[model samples]
Target: MKIGGLIKFTLIDFPGRPAAVIFTQGCNFRCRYCHNPELVYPHLFTEPVPQEEIFSFLQRRQGTLEGVVISGGEPTLQEGLIPFTADIKKMGYAVKLDTNGARPDVLAELLDKKLLDYIAMDLKAPLDKYSLITSVDTPPEILMKSMQLIRQSGVAYEFRTTYDKEVLTDADIQALEKLTDKEHYRVQECLPVAKEKAALKVLHKEI
Candidate 1:
């Protein structure tokens, strides 16, 4: 995997555990309010984080850190993810994957192999507004399939949306309810990064 960034430790990223977060580069979705804009836009790809260095840090923190969170522009997009995560698993660390859920086959394989401990899939928008929110041409059909796969996968998972008012509205929420069973969804307040603070505050008020 081409690791774009590595957070040595995080308290909130992986539920209760202190974990390392590996941010992979490149994404299929170009969400306008994406805080990690560098990850999504390849033109700005940062130098890859040295894998050996990351592994060494993980090894040192083995007893202290309980888990590792593999997040990305889209972690599943990287073909090396399985083997890379497999290595982490061997180091006796629980693994959690944060994905866009576009690749069901990869998700299935990882779960089947018991390589992942938890999964977090993002709902970019209401079904119909996917392309609009992503700022890219997205196939609603494929996204629907991914949603179904996750629901039925029986893995510990959460379906979350970063509710941004500029891209999502009440009508979009209704459309989301129609597309997905609302019982499985979680809506979160969009946290403002330094660059996105003003816009996020205004949208927070609207929400």
Candidate 2:
């Protein structure tokens, strides 16, 4: 739980609730259009905010904040994620997780424990173009398995893709239809020069 950044309040992040956003550090995927380069690129990362500091803030916001959003450089990558989220839930706040869907095992465990209230998984691209878009050698099956786990977990969830014309084509979006029906999917526009505020607006919206 290395917290790279913290947004004390957000109206749109958790859907129908006021919440705080904790941005974790380090990512497995290196998408070219990633807006949070500080979270993803090690060289760009700043000193991590202490865990106690985050907890203290959450404690103070107890009645004010309805939920907590655990977003990341891939939150599941952090080994302490489950415990961290459990603690948040214990604090009487609902929790939401944003991830790349590369680790189905971790996702399953959290769902099994009823630790997350909502889950948002990013679909980097169609199976054939995944590696090219993610800039990693991610197995398509792994991503597919994560999708299956989310759908079957019966937890509220959404599958989203950043629509970057250079990295993903119209056909790629069409292919994503095979993964989930329309109700559970969203396509966000990712402009090359968009700032964090713009990106956050796109990422936090419900379809």
> Model 2 lDDT vs. the true structure?
0.87
lDDT of 1 at 178: 65
Pairs in clash, predicted candidate 1: none
RMSD of 2: 4.1
For 113-182, candidate 1 gives per-residue lDDT tens digits of: 8898878889888766787768787677777777777777777777788888877897776676666667
Give per-model CA RMSD: 5.7, 4.1
lDDT tens digits, residues 1-207, model 2? 777888888998888889999999999999888888878889977778889988999999999999999998899999899999999999999999999999999998999899988999998888888888788998888998999988988788899999989877788898897668899999998966467746644433421
lDDT of each: 0.80, 0.87
Summing lDDT over every window of 10 consecutive residues in candidate 1, give the lowest-scoring window.
198-207
Best by TM-score: 2
